[model samples]
Target chain A: MRLLLVEDELEMAAALGAALGRYDMILDHAPTLDHAMAALANHVHDGIILDRQLPDGDGLSLIPRVRALKSGIPVIVLTARGAVDERVRGLDMGADDYLAKPFAVEELLARIRALMRRSPDIAPITARIGNLVFDFDGRQASVNGRILDLPRRELLVLEALARRQGRTVQRSTLEESVYGYDDEIQSNSLDAHVSRLRRKLSETGAGVEIHSIRGVGYLLRPSL
Target chain B: MRLLLVEDELEMAAALGAALGRYDMILDHAPTLDHAMAALANHVHDGIILDRQLPDGDGLSLIPRVRALKSGIPVIVLTARGAVDERVRGLDMGADDYLAKPFAVEELLARIRALMRRSPDIAPITARIGNLVFDFDGRQASVNGRILDLPRRELLVLEALARRQGRTVQRSTLEESVYGYDDEIQSNSLDAHVSRLRRKLSETGAGVEIHSIRGVGYLLRPSL
Candidate 1:
């Protein structure tokens, strides 16, 4: 997940950026509301962690603007003020969650998770194609109750395909989901992983086939 | 997840730290094999990201030591050498995964996820208590297919309780899971969240009850 953290304090931002990265969530830092607005305009984010105290104005003010720019994007207000009224005010102003300063990183993570859960776009916990059952949450795949022990890249490739089974998943989308932004994309890496995944699935009698859509993307479906 | 990253390059360590933090993964940096050993002895980590070239010795040499120290701990070797032979050598030496330098962080994360999923300790994707069903990965709870709209903190409290329904979850464990490592725990905060959660559950007719075990912790079970 990609998140925008609107925090001015460099140390705090660094600390938070490090914490959230470990969970595989990408974070973009905006030191002020103006920067935050620019970031929001340029990039799509799964959620926003807004610091109430900003150089330009209260972070709470950004909630309505965020709602205007992207309706229903989750926002969590972060402030040093732990007052109940401040939290209520932030909530009333369109914040989905309110977290006080000196909070635990775990608590912040939990809040983010909770908010993301409420999103309408969340995929089901599991998906199936033929005899293959993939547990999206557990990151495991099994066929006939036996787990398929696959290499990481292969599994990731399968995951991208499995999530959109029977539908053509564009190559760029698969690459984006499987590779980091900084990764130097190898033109053939995805293909190699997909080929290996296909071999493993067939060997395991997963009863699934992956069809490449000539220069476009790949699709997974039940084997005829 | 807490990870031990044994990398000699200062910039590389800093970049990885920042990147991994965004995902909510805690990284502990070790500049040398000695420091890495010390960290492993002192703290339990979910995995290790090993850099092949270290000041003290070749990182591959440390794999056996790591395995001896903590069996079943996943290790991923990062090296400038991407040769197939070198990759094989690293795997033979006990590295669970090997990534050539310039690899995407997303690939590393995927490898970690795949390895963790193979562990027996992974929890089910969802848990149930009476009418309340909690989706662990999605971080949402529902009562008989009706999603519960909850404030973040209250949901977190309920999550900690619900995961181990019918059993006592220690206060420290609940606090640790709910709060961050740096959070200053308020004596009454847990109580406040639990009380609010109880009220909300009752209002929603969740058919579950949270029981406090005095000084011990809390438990969730079907409401009689």
Candidate 2:
């Protein structure tokens, strides 16, 4: 996918550019809002990574301009710490999503993919993989339209994994997202959840695998 | 609207605490992430103001912990400049909203309102006043479930009022949220929008009065 990253900081900009590039996606870096606006005027980008504060001015001013021009192009605002008004205003201004600064490259990639997919429209309430359908808000999983009663923790775990379908999610991220921050997770708790879930899927003959990435994380993909 | 302020900085924390106290809400202050977690475990708070950079650890880790303990408690992360990752990670970790450092107390108060009204499972998307119901996401006013389509600006203006329900949404906040940042709104655009939407609402035979606060914003109240 083509991306435009609008950021002023040199080192962070270069690092983000390189990280996205590693995913085999083309990234165009715009150092200022003017450059970003010009890039918007010139190119067709599948996605955008916008920094809330720029050298010349506050980036919020440019949000409506991009929306006016690109209309539905996915724009993800990168906000500095504790800028709540900026985050809400950005969303109200038609940004598809908002990301805070001092973020990890992997988290950035995850948010990018999620926003890019939803920018064109609201994501379907249910996402289907193989024969399994997951209802996001309802937090239920079904196989061939049959509701599969799943545990809350497993469901949260599954939702985290499915958001990154076909891509790996790090163990730490999963632990933090699915479990409360201070929960003392047993060494094999995540593995145990995955094992139980895998068994359940296999029982229903759903041809999907929660593949282990070993030391990194796990991925949910159709059985190969 | 009781709040918990979890921040490490002594002076800034005290200032924010006093500012929030003036709003007549309880302000529980904690200096570290662990202490903050303990505070949450002890009592329920309607809203939380968390500093991302706490002495003990990163504040992003506390969101889920707090949320699990008190569902629908609006958390506004207090982020320092240049910490994009912390902001994004906080949101992805289920923070209801974020606020950057160096923000106005008024803006923070406004955000607190927005977040409180929109917290998951707390506020209904559709609000009924007399016979009229406002659908925020759909941006429409309904009379007994019959849709009343409104123009974008007017719809937003109506929502701004409806969010307050029986109370008033400050005009400044209404203007900011509707037109967004960089809106050089001249004339009585806000009032004009409110007038038109109010007329439309009355036309549907829903006896809902949009009371003008005169120099403030508008209020939505059921008319007998």
Candidate 3:
């Protein structure tokens, strides 16, 4: 798999790294973005096409700084046809895929193997229950032993109810998961954000309940 | 946008639904896959183009049953030639894009406009951070306001870190978002699953924190 082309037009990045290195892959080329962040701080590249014009910089400000330092590293973006607002600001700067500029080097190797096959179904960045942990790509969190603060929309609603741990969600699905359904929500805002996330889990006891099924919604039962 | 052309033939699904409704886009046509899951339970298509020789089923087991019920709906298989290992096992059966068989309808309208341009950067899948909440195609999650059972590999590592909300994820970039360097991982065990996800986020008190920079990897700060 491994890839990371970048492109500064050295004959179209050597005809797209010898036509995507004859499809077996393991090609790293980079022509800038400071040699693509010094070959992304030395090796490791399953996907990354980049390019929105770069001899030195401005690849949509390195897509939210390579999604704030490799969040799932698929990227793609290439852009051109009238920039068109760098294809909606390069997928709001996280870029999982995109390719414009008179494309088709076999459609940029089929959109970099469809963003390296929809990024391997996400492995270990960690998220556990019972003992309580949410390494969320190492933003760090500890419970039993101690240490916590959890602000960011209460850790994105506890990683969206631990990514569907027991399931339930609704209060219009937590006001459409942080107001996206085209915002304007109110009506007791997902029950005042689940009553301040159940008083911060009973002020750190962490029994983990977050129940409420009234009109039918909410649920994150760790032990009750 | 608005697509859902499952396919059971009948003249190449009426000439690819009249050239994808003259590219303005909008095609509900189905023929099987139980009329494409009863038109995906009465309409919801922004991307979906199956047909991996589906007479009755095997459209790559409907990509984890449509991402276990909508994790940003983007499916595209359409195989038939040498089937390059059924296009890498239908891209590890999550098929977020693939189109083989004598392709070209303008390469299937640039792979359906690159799968309806990656849902306008995590579209109306309700999202937010700093109190975190991610509806992500209704997979669901919530935090500061409670709800957190989390486990399917920690909800795909909190849906790739709550849809990249204020990102920063390394550790071999979250193991290629899940072992795609050519599979074979069995275990780094991702640092003991990030130390059992920091003890299950303080036993669900959900205050949050998953930081770890030691050698560079992980971050779910939620603005702490």
Candidate 4:
């Protein structure tokens, strides 16, 4: 996932950036509220990590602007202050989740996945084509109640296609959802993922196929 | 909104119950985790306010059960412990929002409203028919950019019908949404609210009509 980290603390930001890289997430750091808003204006990040305390202004102040855009981008507020009122205020202003300082990076990763699952336009609840079921929340696919143990990237590729089932999901859109913004896309990496996903689905009697629309994108359809 | 308040504190529960009543929200108080679970098993609540330090177990633990039901019932964790880790843990466990103790009742109300807006099946985003727009998030209706200042119950009645748009929303469902669970139905109260709403829409040139389905419910459709 591509995320913008609006944190003033250089050390925390750098540490988090490296940690999230292991999970294939790219982080763009914004040192101040102004920079955060500017970054948001230029590019769309899948999610945002906002520090309540920023150099220019309070992070809670950014929630209104983010919500005004109505893109439903999930925002996780980070604060050293773990006061109950502060958490309530952040959520009321539109932060999807909240994390206090001194948190484990694993927790952050888990929260991000949870937020992505609830995102309407991003991850659909589940998609069914014929007998195959792609459950976005579980990050798994199953055929007739039998699970398919596909790798992480493969599952992501399926999720992108499943969300747009019966229609083509552009190659660029699939890559954006599967890989972080700054990740160097190995020429055939997407094809590799889709190929493996297709094989796994067939092996499980999924009754579905991933059809490539030459030079365009990929579509998920029921097999004859 | 119909809510379940799972807090052991009788005084706080009573205060919040009364406050929410003023806004036409019904509160079902469950003083313990067991009671909360039992209440949930028997009846449905639009949302829940959970106290983390429950008598039997941690409030966060209940989130799994709530989510397991796949009802999409929003859970807001309330706690006196202001520790940062606790807040993150609550959210990671699936609490929709978190509130520390000593919070303003108004903040809780705002968070509840926010959660209701995100709930797809419960409260839809915005329903648009011709020039009329029912903005659920703002809890307001506008026509040609001009806002119609609708009363609380009137707005709720409009929201219930607008969500189903072309189809009729049953009278029972509309009553459940507009009035509290125990609020006495004054025979034609719903009709009164709908009448006012319909007239307001016409007065504002909102090209739509609320059609009463005889003895059934109400449907909103574009006016000829």
Task: Estimate the Cα RMSD of every predicted model relative to the unseen true structure.
Answer: 19.5, 18.4, 18.3, 16.0
lDDT (CA) per prediction: 0.78, 0.72, 0.65, 0.78
Query: Which consecutive 10 residues in model 3 chain A have the weakest lDDT in total?
Result: A114-123
**lDDT per residue as tens, model 2, B1-224:** 67888888889878887887888878888999888888888887888888877898888788778767776567778777557566545555556556667878876787677555433234356687898777564345668645554666876777777788899888888888898789778888778888887788888887898888888777889876
What local lDDT does model 2 show for residue B205? 83
Docking class of 4: incorrect
lDDT of 3 by residue, A1-224 (tens): 78888888789878777887787776788888888888987988777888877877688787667667777677777777756555545554556546668776876676555444344244247566665655564454445524445555665676677667678887666666766777776577556766786687667776676777788878787774
Superposed Cα deviation of residue B131, candidate 1 (Å): 44
Write the residue-wise lDDT of candidate 2 on A50-149 in tens digits: 8877899977778788778867678788887788997898888777788888888898788876664333232323344555666543456667546778
Q: Considering just chain B, what TM-score does every model have? A: 0.56, 0.54, 0.31, 0.80
Residue B78 CA displacement from its true place in model 2, Å: 1.5
**Which predicted model would earn the best TM-score?**
4
lDDT of 2 at A35: 91
lDDT of 1 by residue, B69-154 (tens): 88778888886653755655565566666666887777677677766764535534878898888866545677875656566677
Instruction: Give candidate 1 regions above 4 Å deviation.
Output: A9-14, A28-44, A54-57, A120-122, A136-142, A145-163, A179-204, B1-224
Candidate of highest DockQ: 3
Clashing pairs in 4: A84-B100
Position A115, candidate 1: lDDT = 73
Model 3 achieves a DockQ score of: 0.03
Model 3 docking tier (incorrect/acceptable/medium/high): incorrect
Model 1 agreement with the true structure over A1-224: per-residue lDDT tens digits: 56789999999988997897666556788999999998888766779999988999888889889989888688998866558888899989989988888899999998887676445333433455677877653467778667788766677678778776655566776776566333459679888889888888899998999977654577787787
Candidate 2 error regions (>4 Å): A1-224, B120-224
Candidate 4 structure quality by residue, lDDT tens digits, A111-213: 7776675543343567889788776654556677555556568867888888899999888999999988998687998998898888888887889999999
Tell me the lDDT of candidate 1.
Answer: 0.78
**True-vs-predicted CA distance for residue B166, candidate 4, Å:** 1.8
